[model samples]
Target chain A: MAAQTGESASTVLVCGEVRTCLLPTTQALDRRGAAQLLRLRADMYVRVSERPIMHVLSPETLTGVDCRLPASDGSRTRAVGTVIGRAALTEGRLLQTTSYFGLPAVGPDTRRPWGQYLVRPGIVEPFGMLPRKATAAGVLQGARRGELDTGTIAEGLAAQLCRHELLDRRAPFASAPTRLRWVALRTGGDRPAALTNFTLAEDGLRTVKLRLPPDVPASAAAGLCEDLALHDWLLTHVQRMLDDHPFDRADDSRSLAALRPAVTHLLHLWMPRAHVDGALAHLWDTLEAAPGFTRQWQNLVQRIRDQLTLLDLAQCRRAASSKGCEE
Target chain B: MPERVFRESTAEPRTRAVPLAHLSLELGHLYMEDFQLGPKRLGEHFAEVRIWADAVRARAARRVKRPRISTCFLIDDYFTRFSTPDEVIPTVLEEAGRAGLTIDYLARESGCAVADGVALAESVAHRLVESPPPGSYGFRPPASRTGWLTNGSRSPASPPRTDRGRTDWEPPVETAARNHSIFMDVELWSDDKNGQRVWSCSFLAAVWQLARLGLLRHLGEPVLVPREQDVAALPPDWDRLPPLIKVSATKAAFSAYRTCTLVPHHFLPVENAVRLVLDQVDVDTAALAQVAKRSADEGMPVPPEVAQRATYVFYEEPGDPIEDGKH
Candidate 1:
């Protein structure tokens, strides 16, 4: 038998994609509004966390998948199960949708009854033995024709939420949505979860690789990746705002107008590892040390603050000079 | 340590677990035609179902030492309303009693669509996640939008080749077919003359099956809760009848870990459509897990797939000797 016929709790691989974008609303939503907006399932409650930040999470939903597993070495492996997806809104400003599924090393040769798969949500079992490393690499690199595509699922969910009546569909700024494709391979419990690689590809696509402890579930790994995605997006977005050179104008008034949304909407959303599982939270330390997500964010934030200060001084001087002329 | 452990009710949702039996055996379905044929026809139907019910009980006994099995009867009040519940209930119960069968639960088919103000059918419809076709890279419009759920890839929308160079005809192919295909596309719902969405019989059947499997939940609460009203108090109006009533004195639960249905041979097409719909529904995972855990604790683990957990016996329709001969 190519695949085993019973339940297996240990996950061999986890693959996911996260799509992050500013909530397309003129005004940020309050806790109550956020709840209404993220109500994806009428029968399930939308989780709202008040402390740390106003983070709202929609109930996990499943999308059934019965397709070829993406293998970088070009091997054809069929997998059948459901991929789980959930939408999260941070501080009612940033919206993110994550689509993910864990894979076991082996599965039954034929697709079992759908009810069996339904019971094990977010698990996509492959026929026979799973090519773990190649599949992981395949997820990060990209899916081929007829291969499972988590990015599209994530993007589709984000689009669906954006189209919700609660949202005005009018973003405060013109910024592209960021896509983070991630893969986590199981490692022994002796080794704690660690971030192995982070790559920023073209066209808003970022990839992260991690070695997660067996005890840490795929959902935790997904949570860690989502945190990384949100922070990285904040840095990228603010850097682009800095590049726009709102201060290039003769007077900094226009610059202040241009940057108000960032100060109002995006800056405070940079709290990293806030809601991530403690077991996998330390993975952020590696990114903080090297590329320094916090360091870059702090710099942009200071620059924005200085610009606001400079803008204030200019206005004061102009008022003083006008008063002198009147005397 | 902080003095307070903050909590949000929405954040920590709970699923109310339903008491589960080892098997929920459906005795038979009553339709308007069967009612018009009178009590003798109902007696004959129950007699045929009695033989299969015994077989189902024997099968359940093999799985567990002491199997808790419940029998349910569904009366068709949705598609075509017949006599009032007051008239229908007594006669149906008497016939089943004559055949030495006891129906623990009596349910109306309309109850599957909407039970106690909960739109069970629409909620289940929203939960439908279409099985991805071979080349379903992702983000195809949901199958629910077209009001049809299919098991395979439908032929392309393009018509036959023409002078203008349109594409040629293609055949629909089932996703899991080995040698050949038996493609099925079942309609989930359609608009009525008044433009109100009418849930299809097959779709409601799928919902009924999910309820029997103890999988339907509304806002983390159990749906289709059987009212403990006395059967003798059944109302003259079908509208006033409870969706489900505990008719028997036995303590067996209405829902179960698995279900075995004894239906008539002519209803085979409808049941097959039910399977097609059930295969695609993404049921509440928490409820599914509860059943899995409870069943495992009892030393009778169910198959993972919701559809696989259901078994059926398609006997010839009672008093249809000519139809049996033709077959």
Candidate 2:
């Protein structure tokens, strides 16, 4: 463990990542099942709030880690601290876990008691002065074998929850899960919350790096990232469905087979920024302006709708012709 | 946001607070090996333990004018079933009296794993979050393979840790090492002949830390609540006994804001592993908040990290008149 100086206790570079996956049950959990499924700890009930969406938030949990800080310049500064993790269920269909922690500007020269690290639940104190720009770049670039990477922690947590006995080990659709690794480099209160970068990486991983005003807690960054990851997952999943049928009007059965899950499970799930806090909502705006998350989602939905329409007409003609023959 | 909001009873989250004390000081933990060594071991253990127990009480006194302090002892019945509690209780009490120590609560180690129809150990196991080694970029370590916890990235020690057929060996790297590594990987549990899994001594000690810290809850209620030990004679079997037995009248609660443990050097490694487990456990937020609030209100706040709330003094095992308790 890095010797925790007073400076590290008050963090400077706050970074974390969120991973989103499908609930493994054959059917999406109802409100009751969602609560039961997300009761990660036996002691506390899952936080189920109903308004925009019936959302469930599990109690926060911790994972301890000691590893080198991912410095862009390759200056080796080891860090030791606990990363905080929690799960959120959206409408009982999407399960997401955000595993995140932060590093302070500088730390004490010597390591202290482990209890000291536990007290700062989600904050991983760096051993020496932090290189904010380089470390953030390194984190965005992803871990290089031994650097501390929170996305794995987030994914690990989601995987653990998926294995719960409560889950039937069946998913309604066979869609790939995604991890959105995020970092919020704290630049003090003078600036507005601005997104630095959001990139779709290979192998079901997404990276988001941003700058936040001091007012927005690192958790807000996580919330924004979870929202992004969840919606991106929905898009990626539905896109795969559309990918199956390229409007080959002759092939009705295969198209319908592939598109059925998209309509049944995912179409209505597209309500972006439903749960993101107001402070960090603008980050979604940047994505909306550029490639536009909702635009791509709308296009995918249209493709699904267009294919389903073709399938609908094909079914109607067969019924009418059969009726005429009977007459 | 849309209209027609709905809320379910089970969905709302709540954390019922446990009775709190200023300090929860553990007198000692005695394993079967120590027990077989006989009453002489108990005398030496208690004699050495009494020294630090008083120092903790005095420290607590400075925090609160009359600190609500509770002292407890743990007997290992989980790893190996030994003499019946009927025989064990008398000797323990007798030895405690010899040291002028009044044990407020007597607990069984098995209870830390399960008590009162709750699978406490499994619940805790589900809560384990791996500490991220540096370069942890979103890739989760496979923790379940060996049921082990480590302070750093593991070396390619065994087939389970490294890929099959890869002969290249990698040194286990401690994330927080000054230079060279003091790598420690602890096995948390293994399956027995009946295929029922058994938690290792290190993992149980971690659970013991949570219990002592009063961070454990089962269905929003405290686990291992002390039952008054009115029955002078304990049951013939360990299974018949309640997990926690209160031995003497005291205003203090079993759970507290801080915990201090006195253990043998063998436990030094075990305690280190316990810290590894503890660093990642997400305790109930409401419980954490309550402790934070109370501690702040009392004008002596605790470290925000859960693991930091615990303290341990690892000394050489009982043999000679114990010199200044070793590290």
Top candidate, metric DockQ: 1
lDDT of 1 by residue, B122-193 (tens): 999888877877555565546778899888888988758878886778999887787899999899899989
Clashing pairs in 1: A3-A107, A43-B219, A115-B304, A115-B305, A115-B306, A116-B304, A116-B305, A116-B306
lDDT (0-100) at residue B326 of candidate 2? 65
Give stretches of model 2 more than 4 Å off: A1-9, A16-99, A108-115, A141-181, A190-211, A233-248, A251-258, A278-327, B1-12, B26-64, B79-101, B124-191, B199-203, B232-237, B260-289, B301-327
After TM-score superposition, the amount by which residue B233's alpha carbon in candidate 1 deviates from its true location, in angstroms, is 2.3
Give the Cα lDDT of each candidate: 0.85, 0.78
lDDT string for model 2 (A183-210, tens) is 8777766777888788988999788878
Model 1, span A1-327: residue lDDT tens:
001112224678889999999999988999999988888888788888887888888887777777888988888889988788889999999999999988999898986656567666788989999999889989998888778999878988898889989888888888899999999888876877789999999999999999877777788788888899999899999999888774756456678877887898888887888888777777889998998889989999999998888889888999999999999
Q: Could you give candidate 2's per-residue lDDT for residues B295-325 as a string of tens digits?
A: 8888878787777778987766777544457
Estimate TM-scores for all models: 0.92, 0.74
Q: What lDDT score is found at residue B141 in candidate 1?
A: 45
